[model samples]
Target: MAIKPITGMLRRQAVLDISVALGLGTASGYAWWYGYHVPAVRHRDQFYQKIEEERAKAMGQQSS
Candidate 1:
């Protein structure tokens, strides 16, 4: 089989396709991180913070 030579138009088209793929990949990655990861991490931190606050209050009441 003969190898196909890369033409200028083909090169440009390839570039556009690659750029679009990279952009979409970046956007989806950001959406997943912000929508899912960030909220989960925030919820976890808030949960721990609430637990700490309750513990502190309980300790204060014991000391009083």
Candidate 2:
């Protein structure tokens, strides 16, 4: 009777929650992988290279 309807509603809500959580997690992962991780890695490499070049120049000056 009433118990059946309540059970059905709870089951539906649980399914909806799971669906939304999965969707959010997927979107967040994609954003991090494509938006942040790739460009950040590239920028980090470039930054380190610049630092190394500057260090070498400073060392050359001191040696000269």
Candidate 3:
């Protein structure tokens, strides 16, 4: 026996899958950017400043 596929149902399912994939991809990208990337970028200068201060303090201690 051979099975036949329905055209409209297949098309509908394909469209739904594509739309879901696109939506999830966009949402994850947005989440990653805001959750990880943005915070790192925002704190970058502060991180550098703290490191510089620590290094200066170490240098002063070494020189003493």
Candidate 4:
């Protein structure tokens, strides 16, 4: 079987397609990491504040 050589236009098209795929992949990855992953991480102060508020509310109810 004879091997077919890639033409200049084909090579350029291939390079462009790969570049676009990489760029889109990077953007989507950043979006997922920053938007979904970062927000999913719990903040200590927010969690503690909620707990403290609930405790104070419970104490106030019991004292009344």
Candidate 5:
């Protein structure tokens, strides 16, 4: 007996599923590395200070 080849919608769906899986894996891997592998000191203190100031300003605006 010979193996049959996939054709039409089934083949398309298989390709789509594989592409989506690879895309998701890449995105999640990047997220994991960004969140855990990188050191906090990678960013300068001034950057964090600016973010903190912006957050405080937003909070102040919300309360007003």
Candidate 6:
């Protein structure tokens, strides 16, 4: 049986694909944690306050 050699561009493309997949997986995990797990841990008032604080901080940073 003969072995086939992969070209340089193909190897580069495979590396890029793997990097993209890893990045997307990390983002999805963060989204799930914030969207579901975080809310479940807090009471209503506390949760709203946390959200408000985050929003205010973001806006403050944006304005600067």
Question: Highest TM-score among the candidates is held by which one?
Answer: 1
Tens digits of per-residue lDDT, candidate 4, 3-53, equal: 997679888999999999999999999999988877766566678889999
Between 1 and 4, whose TM-score is larger? Answer: 1
Model 2 stretches with alpha carbons more than 4 Å out? 1-4, 48-64
Give the TM-score ranking, best first. Answer: 1, 3, 2, 4, 6, 5
Positional deviation of 15 in candidate 2, in angstroms?
A: 0.8
**Per-residue lDDT of model 6, residues 1-64, tens digit only:** 9898766988899999999999999999999899888887667769799999999999999999
Off by over 4 Å in 6: 1-6, 43-64
What residue pairs are clashing in model 4? Answer: none
Question: Highest lDDT among the candidates is held by which one?
Answer: 1
lDDT (CA) per prediction? 0.98, 0.95, 0.96, 0.90, 0.86, 0.91
Q: lDDT tens digits, residues 1-64, model 5?
A: 9999756988899999999999999999998788865645556666889999999999999999
For candidate 3, the clash count comes to 0
Candidate 1: pairs in clash: none
TM-score of every model versus the real structure: 0.78, 0.59, 0.63, 0.56, 0.48, 0.52
Error of 4 at 6 (Å): 9.6
TM-score of 4: 0.56
Q: State the displacement of the C-alpha of residue 42, model 3, in Å, after optimal TM-score superposition.
A: 1.2
Candidate 4 residue-wise lDDT at 45: 62
Tell me the spans in candidate 1 whose CA falls farther than 4 Å from its real position.
1-6
Backbone clashes for every candidate come to 0, 0, 0, 0, 0, 0
Query: Which structure is stronger by lDDT: 2 or 3?
Result: 3
